[model samples]
Target: MFGGVSGKGRTGPVLAVLAAAGGLVVFGPAGGSADAAAPCAGRPVKAVGFGAGELRLYKGNGYACAVTAAKNPGTRRRMSVTIQARGSAPAGDSGAYTQLAGPVTVHAGSRCVRATGAIAGGGSAQTGWVC
Candidate 1:
């Protein structure tokens, strides 16, 4: 399982195929300042969600990152991003993607990546799922 979205049961390759079919490209570094944007820096892929907020995905340098933006729903919410090599679980001896608090960026050096916005009140939404 990829952590948050359990029903998809989809693999990394499938997600990557979907992303590519959607016109998204693999990202890489562009020489400049460290602050300079990567190839996929500003572009974000939208994910499935509950329609309460906005979720975006960014991929670069073999890592995938996510950002979530929501209106005032009066609840504490945070975004999570995770990634793993193709056909690998989020947890195992293979080492899973490092989880990070978002809209901050994270290094998901895996073949596939997933993101979700979790509310402190026990509600959550999938932000992005891609390879």
Candidate 2:
């Protein structure tokens, strides 16, 4: 019944799972599952708003994170988030998501960052850099 049972127990929180598209995806009951936190790590640094949603940034322990949060979530839609550290290649995420996208992280110790986000058909981006 589980997506792909991987745990040791049968009726004691099996935690069914499987790797898909380079990410670990979990399968749960019909309504939804628990622990569905945003994909990023660290404390929020900034939030850039757009027509459909907002781009959120976070920084912690010498790393930077980014996520695109839909203003009104629930429906599956295209979402994306991108962040680029000064003198470093950009890191980002884009796909069909129910509420948000990304959590794209990159090493950004003492460096400025620029970011962009898109949801549905709307988009937003940072014109300059910020730390």
Name the candidate that leads on TM-score.
2
User: Would you list the clashing residue pairs of candidate 1?
Assistant: none
21-103: candidate 1 lDDT, tens digit per residue: 65533454445653563223644555544444544567767655564444344444443433333454541111111222354
Compared with the true structure, the alpha-carbon lDDT of candidate 1 equals: 0.48
Candidate 2 has its poorest 10 consecutive residues by lDDT at 15-24
> Model 1: runs farther than 4 Å from truth?
1-42, 73-101, 108-110, 127-129
Instruction: Report the Cα lDDT for candidate 2.
Output: 0.76
What TM value does model 2 have?
A: 0.67
- Where does model 2 exceed 4 Å of error? 1-39
